[model samples]
Target: VGGAWFAGDCAALSECYSAGSQYSAAPILPDPLVLPTVQHLRESWDDYQDAVEDDPEVGEDGFIFDFAPDELHKANISGATHEIEMVQYVADPVIHGVTGRSGITLVEYLRVSISWGGMPGWSFKPDQAPAALAALRVRPDF
Candidate 1:
């Protein structure tokens, strides 16, 4: 597995590095037999969306209920110099099936940036450039 550097403001962070960030990796399945299951999951998600849209209490505000506002706020805090974002298996989908089912997982690492807090407040010193550059060489496409 590999990691990347994601820079910019909260909007960019939300669009590229946040929880609902898009995954560009191709699908991985050990066998073609899992197609039905995959289809079912997709259909189930569509149905779930419909159900939410029809529900008065949950979908009345016109937005699908997902993460809590506070949680999202914490995840997208401005001026947060050090933070970690989990890159799920979907981002780099490769799975080995031992049985009929496979479990999804994720890789996480701390993303340290001086862009938000400015250089004076940055904990990452000049000496750490080589290490930081080595660690974050691959910037994924959004």
Candidate 2:
């Protein structure tokens, strides 16, 4: 998706038992983390969307701005990426609308709280999203 994409994986190479009789410690491998350092968007300002970007009434700051393309396009028309930017979120639980794909797949977050604000960062802001992000439908490979 657009905005940014980064990821990291921590695989245990070995474990040791703790005083309580539990294998609590694991030695981490080198370069245990992998993630993007820059921010990018999967979707960009295409020619057809230039209008939406230029429309004074509906562009940029509209209360319910739809980033749909002006003409026929796959992402927008097919709901594969009908991105929108409303003046507010109101916790609608949806942002990017798409089919054959989870609308919130790229937006939905996990372990978002005080502790995770610093993973790629400790912040829940969308700008801080890393490759480790996922949707509810996804499963963590333990």
Candidate 3:
């Protein structure tokens, strides 16, 4: 009866927005239970770029790197939903293989970068300190 009311209204609005879709499968309803804070994949990209510059093989421009789709997981956040557990940033470059050749060896290349941020469950309410620190695991989408 509490947050569920808000969740229901949100669901209704979402359905209304999604009216008369030509798609076969129903659009996934956004989960009401899980909430998110200020997060973005762009930051991850930037960090990756920085790491690449540090590598001798990657050169100044980052034209050689490839990005993968972001992945999400549960990532324990015990106290507040907005709280971040831990965020790990990774970027890698992949090298392609060519067809048959003589004795020459042509190898593909890859560059990887990683960074982390945020603490989970840090109660803004001042009381739940221990639980917050204990929840210091990586965030799902990091």
Clashes of 2: 15
What would the per-residue lDDT of candidate 1 be over residues 71-100, giving only the tens digit for each residue? 122224331121112223236332222122
- TM-score, candidate 2, is 0.24
Which model, 1 or 3, shows the larger TM-score? 1
Query: TM per model?
Result: 0.20, 0.24, 0.19
**Cα RMSD of predicted structure 2:** 15.7
lDDT of 3 by residue, 45-71 (tens): 566667767885654443332222111
**Candidate 3 accuracy as TM-score:** 0.19
Q: Give the TM-score of candidate 1.
A: 0.20
Any residue pairs clashing in model 3, and if so which? 86-139, 93-110, 93-111, 95-108, 95-109
lDDT of candidate 2 over 25-45, digit per residue (tens): 312111111112223222333
Task: Give the 10-residue window scoring lowest on summed lDDT in candidate 3.
Answer: 108-117
Q: CA lDDT of each candidate?
A: 0.28, 0.29, 0.25
Candidates in order: C-alpha RMSD to true structure: 17.4, 15.7, 20.1
